[model samples]
Target chain A: MKLINKRNFISIVCIFFTLITCGKLLYERALNFTDRYYTDNIFTILGFSVLITLILSLHFYLQKFPFWLVIIAQYALTVGIVFLAIFIHGRFSTNAPTAYWDMFVSITIPFLIGALVYYICFFVQIKRANKVLEKLNSEE
Target chain B: MKLIKTREENLEENYLELHYDKIDEETNAVLDRLRDTLRYIEGTYEDKKVTIALTDIFYIETVDRKTFAYTKDMSVEIKEALKDILEEYSKIGFVRISKSVIVNIFKIKKLQGDINMRVIIFLKNDEKLIMNRSYKNDFYKRLNDLKGRSAK
Candidate 1:
């Protein structure tokens, strides 16, 4: 976000909100996924912050790629991340959920929603900018 | 600022020229506008020399240190560095997007930005360019100027 700049006040605000949001998700996961809850710590907070930042930075870089490529890459990346987490926790059991595609659905749907929100916000920003440009043009 | 008037009548053409002891920022900006309006940078294409009107260019980009100008139907390699070309055409409409790219705001069809960090600038030719976050402000400022002029 443009909030992450040299200005201390704005950067701090951005970081504060980021931590709050990520921390809330982690807390919810800890309540639901007990086995994975043990790994939560300061390192976990730091890790989540870094991971979220990297994923969001893709929005800026993804413009260089085609729409379809971005979709495939994002899908692969999300699945890869979930697999990595499972490996780290040593959860290798072949459950019924795997057969039913539970893990895949859980990981992919949120990412799709994220992509949707991103485009909606993008359209809103463009509309606002065009409106301002129109107002400026209408002036002397 | 000083204004000097001359009464020399020209039979062939009439024009204004600036003779300044030192070129300040404002004076240099005015000079850039005058030069870009009348100047046509030469390029080589298909083993032939082609002169490009600065305003007609949609964008100029450098790939592997070679600069090419993109118009509607022509892609001509110009004998100029990207930075130099930007300076020469800056007053007309071009603004740098990335390290190796500069685009003319007048040629842009639409602009959209995402939270993902990249802004999409659609050209009149339907080609899209990624607007780096670093150069977004300058691009919009130039766009505003272009819009104002079109309205007038």
Candidate 2:
């Protein structure tokens, strides 16, 4: 199947980037960090989000490819990008390698949860579609 | 053209026979329509050739230059090329939903909108196929025509 058009993809990426940046701002504010580089954090978040979006969109072109291959490639890229971003952020902030590991764990745990939620939702959609198919076939 | 009706008491099955002096566009159209009326297509199941009824197919898909017709419980390899099969069966209900797939519209129970302008067609067999953007217009037009005809 064809992918989302370029225009729509761009719009969606921009909207999500904005939301993520806002979320980051709120998270840091709630933690009450004494020293905050708002502009630098926004830029880092922007770069990370854009990279993740690009990685995820690669699946659109790989529609004919094996599903497992696509999912594995995307998941690998996402994890790698998240780890690299956190590592770099930690290096610039505190120069502590241990902090980077902690940050990575914090980020990846939520990402894994999100992936699990996605699979659950996908399963539900298929189940509902099957039910509708049965109903329609019965009517026929 | 003249129409003729013949009654034969010993005939086993009804058949249409055409006698023409020359083949033209109109004659080709009639022949095409007649071909589409055929009920079965040749397929290979377990290395043995079989005739699969058109109504039994959920969808036909081309993969790596080979074509397969999927039914509720089995998938049979069709010898005919995807385009040729579609050409012969499109008049009945076969519609190209993507570059490599032709779905029997009658087997589609419902269509759901998918992200990225694609459509998910749920079939009677609890299978789903994606209708690509490039073929969306033609597929929808054919569906509308089918609906119109059935309403009459």
DockQ of each candidate relative to the true complex: 0.15, 0.07
**Which regions of candidate 1 are displaced past 4 Å?**
A1-46, A55-63, A90-113, A128-140, B1-32, B35-38, B44-52, B61-77, B96-101, B109-152
* Per-residue lDDT over B1-152 for candidate 2, one digit per residue giving the tens place of the 0 to 100 score: 66578888989977778889988897897677556656788889899988887878889999999999998887999888888987777878789988899998879887776433346887878888887645765776676666554444
Give the TM-score (vs. native) of candidate 2. Answer: 0.54
Please give the lDDT score at residue A46 for candidate 1.
49
- TM-score of every candidate's chain A: 0.52, 0.69
Residue runs of model 2 more than 4 Å from their true location after superposition: A2-5, A61-72, A81-99, A102-110, B1-53, B58-80, B83-152
Judging by TM-score against the true structure, name the best candidate. Answer: 2
